[model samples]
Target chain A: MFRSRTRFRAYSLAASCLLLGVSSSALAGDAPSTIDPLNSPSWQYVQARYFDGQKLIFDDRIKVLAPTAAEDPLDVPIMVTSDGIADVEEVVVIADLNPIQKILAYQPKRASPDISFRFKVEQSTPVRAAMRTKDGVWHLGGTWLSAAGGGCTTPSGGSSGLWQGHLGEVNARIWPREDKNQRLRLRVIHPMDTGLAKGVPVFYIDQITLRDDSGAELATLQPFEPISENPVLSFDLKNVGPVHVEGHDIQGNTFTATIQP
Target chain B: MRNGVIGLATFVSVAAGAGDDYHLQPVPVGDSAQVFVGKTEGFARGNGGNIVNTGFIVGTDGVIVIDSGPSRAYGEQQRAAIEKQTALPIRQVFITHAHPDHFLGDQAYSGIAISALPKTIAAIRDHGEALSDNLYRLLGGWMLGTRLVPPDHAAQPGTVIVAGRKLRLIAAQGHTDADLMIFDEATRTLFAGDLVFFQRAPTTPNANIEQWLSTLDTIDQLDFQYLVPGHGPIVQDHAAIAQTRDYLRWLSTTLHNAATRGWDIQEVMQTPIPERFRSLSVLDQEFPRSVTHLYPDIELNVLPKQTAAKHE
Candidate 1:
């Protein structure tokens, strides 16, 4: 197989070289050369934000786990589990490279030891997983990447012009067998633009909140540059209740969905 | 030397932010071969042995250029250098692949026959503007120094351009679907782009390892004397191609096992690049991402929904 593949590729190379007879003069037109990054700004500070002079310490306890060291960095799998996370009431994932610093913020409703969800990393940077436990102690974990680059710069999603066409479609699927009530997964389709790119218009999601069918807020996530293009989130939901999530970006774009019980 | 962001800027940012021991050095190739901007030398050497250089082939009638530097502004700088070196006009720009750094400068060569693989042209048309837009938005004022140019002509198999010298666009898949290596029958020099990493782990996101490995075998059979990569200094030895082949062989095997074990993607992601591969450029960063890309290549039958979750 290897020998045949080699022979075939060689034949193709020779063929490609033969096709080099196009008019060289016809291919000489050059496009404009100046590029400006600030023409659009999607989010402010796009990556992580430091506050109150209390720098979030970097520890190895917090890490993002996912398949393929490289995926569309936007929706990379991330989980925050640590021995020190038991007392945490809220955690924020921030990406500092983007026009926006805050990616997603999770405010737990109950006392949970750890939190897991799938989030985006716009580029290869030090991702700060900052958690504030019930007692107000902030613990942070940091991980570095080299390849998941240009997250803020990579095109919005796999499909072109989908964000504009499906401006209001928010899809959520809870897995582990819907009745198993073991795991919950949710996805949102929004432009999630950082407003930094050129040509395309700017839009943002002002606010987004996930609630239970009984009108109780289960989780609230704020999207930012670190949140990837189309945001997919997953976590553990122990109780048997119809899950509902609502989100509204800075552009007044709103999305609401209910997971079948 | 106008506004230019070479590997140095990227390395400095990594060091100051992450506290890692990072170093970047510039390497010179040819007699006064430079990569535009302030990088007077021909190559920019990053930590872990990654190098990127820009060179032009001067023929009696015209010049055939390889990958342009980071941006259009930088490309203009490269053009200035080219003018200094050769009186012949740059009549053709042959892109070896579609990575932003490789093909973005097509705009600087006005009226030049820009050539690349068919997929490369499609990728540029598909994502070229978006890439420029993203750079502008993310880098802000810093992006002004860089420029991206979409290709004017697709270098499909059999598309030929006779400019004093015969230059062929070889169909070499693996580094990217748009991967192409420009072969000059005159010098027997192959501009392998990212397909042939000189001293680093060639990034394999859009890469087809199997096809890439096979391409290497084809390259070995070719009668080429010189080799240039998308992100490294020129290669005088054919063994560089073999080295890249060995690295991929290892990666293909290791990652295949991890995927089969149903290992957590992050666990596989966090697993450090073995000590052997660490010296390669972009290995630390590109390795994990390569894992995700490789999974799909090996587990061909598995559905995306079963193997992975949506990005959101």
Candidate 2:
């Protein structure tokens, strides 16, 4: 009886091995490692290398809201407000997975802790909103995104350099559908190539600076190679006046647009 | 030697002014064949010329093209440039792949024998019009838009066409579903389309990095002296092929490890291109994308199917 049991056990083990081999063979060519999305050193570097030892605090005082989807991921509308926390001092947003990580950082001069801005995302990734308090502690909140790929590598909109030729006609839109008194969103159509895209001899934004009717600085925006193709900046510019925004890229090309409030 | 130096000298100014952007230039690689390099538009993504070479086999009958330009505008320029070199009517056109830029110029060869991988021909026949229409909609506003032309003839693997000299088509599948590499045994030249990108970075969105590397291995073993890439300059040295092959191989191995760990695709997009593969030009611009596209394929552990499956 013992000998018979041993033989049966051995036979079943061999059968299971055979089945495993066949199943594995069937999936031989199909494997995740072949083309896994999140498995790049760059991806790891952004997470493991950049976010190390950094504190991303949670701030109930700040709230971020935007539409679920937009035509371009790079320039999505986002509104940041310090609804409860009067201690809020600054707001910074980082697209943890953008070719450029630091998306937008806003420093509020007035006590109005509320802010709005438009920023671009290359692909679907998580965006973190960190609010700094009077105590200098950073609070964090964000959303994960499945972004449109190929936009970063794909050609920009327009036929050649016509957009640059017409840079004077900068279009701007202010956001906050419900609470207009508190927040404002802005978007600019600049060919913010970030010096990485092809076709352009030099890659840089032609402009940056937002001012009031009297040419007073309301919010200042700077772009880096990490800024999405066309910058979609959302900021908290609120007042009863004419606002003019001017920007000059690294190449000394300048463009300005005025917003009537 | 002095003429070549003068030619190189003139090229530097143009290259410097163009900087990262490509300036259309002519590269004469063979006794009878010359390639017209295509520069991308100012806002477009590619920096290097989409190298489109129309070669003359110099046979008794007429001239045959290894591949045509990517668009109708490029096709006209290529044909005009060919006209300047030799007035031999373009008798046949061997398409390398079905990419809009690679075979969209078939309309230029109207009545010529438009040959490609059998599967590629079917793909072009099945989806060429829709793809062309989409491209026209997406990119047509520039440069008078693009024209669409379908293929006529289909060639399977191991197919040989012997006119004055023998030509063999090797169906290489790492770049696209059906990428054909034409071997000119007489000239020892390999007309490799997107399969090779020479100095420029290659697009690996639809590639199987492993298969691509193996195909390169197969190509290295073949006794070819010259390799004409789909994009970038002509590669006279056999070692140039290694540049592309090494990048793909290194990318596959490095990205695979990252995927095994739980890295986010978004995070990967923001990171810099791998330092190891920076030697290939366009790494900064192309690497993020290659990482994005290649990561998904590796994470999935299989190549994305050329055609999606139907489910009710």
Candidate 3:
């Protein structure tokens, strides 16, 4: 059993026959959401690399929701929400087995712990979200997203100077929903190229900062190359009116946009 | 004699999987255009990649084949089926685009002048082998001995006289980089290959959403009564054009908004498809595919940008 467990989790999902042209909706009905004990073989490396060989506890406080299979490996959207985890300092997402792991590291200062964004996957693997509480405990949660594999190794369709004319353009919308909840969503036009594709450089958005009109920080996200091109990030805010989206690409070109409610 | 004939026929059927037969039937459109309506499904072994609409126009002097079909076998069988309808010699073949479904069968029309838009011809020349190999994988034995054949003649936009019939070749783009729509003036029939899909969801593997939407409007303005689509049913009214436009517009708008709203691929896929388009054949398969092909770019365009902080 341990030997079988050592194989890549995505390879196991691939063997389960997800690619015989079965419509994704059909496989979606089955729920395999909960798996225990940090089951992935890459967990050791991830723990040593990101968690510093520290003991991490599996907790329900951190939740991850993603599609069972990635239709387009370059843009697999995922949501990571924390429940009953108070004083959370930061959340780090990792896709075990991806050549380039550490999808993104998020610090939710003024926005809700709930966040949704897109990422790239090179293959089927365990995607985990670990939230560190103020007490220094790392709470982990994740799911297995099955894919035909090669979300990274494959050349990105949007990487061919596709963003040349409109590079650095930003479109944002901040609206208030009922019950006083304000939603913040925006997209930045940049290739976020993984440099995995031939003749392509490793350029991507290094960081994003959301702030209120007064220049007070809302939330900051550090996205890696696995983030899809033109990274679209969404967050729910407890505050209201005039949110500013700010960030820059790897080339040191910076940009800023403000959405008024 | 009947027993001997039956025995020979049985022998032919026994060679099944050797790319022997397409068993095509021509459905008459208006006065002279005969369309071979294909299955409302993607390429599969059961359909032998016969999921494309190929037809011919029978004129006073000769016949003009609209498209070549999917494989050499389909093209040969299409020719046989056309022969059963008229004695006119096959005069000209016009390809709509370079998509494998539209022109892979050109191998069978070797002697005839197979024509297409200049860009269409170049696309086939560049990607023909890869596309044909994919069909062989999808259809297995049905693709037996099939090879890619690019159109030899460059057909410009405007009227072309073929076999005594005046055809208005309308050049457009969107569904693919180069889409050629043929209008049979004599019959008031428009052979809109892949440009218009009726009762089936349009495939957008090579689409530019904004351009496609604009082209749909242009097609709606054309003067034609009968329409032959690349993959679905033939229609007399403008329902096909409407359905095609409605679906594409919704897809493009929804994808853009989804990206702007930071919705992921799964979220976009899970969003309920409007009930109006639920009945379209292959929507289930085509919807996801279009999203895969189009969503990333749509997202890239509308997704906000963070640029160099402005001075001052």
**Per-residue alpha-carbon lDDT of model 1 for A1-261, expressed as tens digits?**
344344335544544544786443432231111111222121122211243423334445665443434256565656666654565667777544544556677776632334544445555554556787666666666454433355555556633775665664655445343444434555455666666556545555656665667878766656555465555555555456577666677655556666664
For model 2, the stretches where C-alpha displacement exceeds 4 angstroms are A1-261, B1-26, B38-56, B126-145, B270-276, B300-312
Q: Global lDDT for candidate 1?
A: 0.57
Mark the 10 consecutive residues where model 2 chain A has the least summed lDDT. Answer: A30-39
Q: Every model's Cα RMSD, please?
A: 19.1, 23.4, 9.2
* TM-scores of all candidate predictions against the true structure: 0.57, 0.50, 0.73
Docking class of 2: incorrect
Model 3, which residues run further than 4 Å from truth?
A: A1-98, A121-151, A154-171, A199-201, A211-217, A242-261, B1-23, B30-32, B44-48, B60-62, B71-89, B122-148, B205-225, B249-268, B291-312
Query: Which of candidates 2 and 3 is the stronger one according to lDDT?
Result: 3
| Alpha-carbon runs more than 4 Å astray in model 1 | A1-73, A84-116, A120-261, B1-51, B134-148, B156-161, B289-312
Model 3, total clashes? 13
Best by DockQ: 3
TM-score of decoy 3: 0.73
Residue lDDT tens for model 3, A137-205: 788988888764567766666666667766667766665766776877777777888888778888888
Which order, best to worst by DockQ?
A: 3, 1, 2
The best candidate by TM-score is: 3
lDDT of 3 at B258: 79
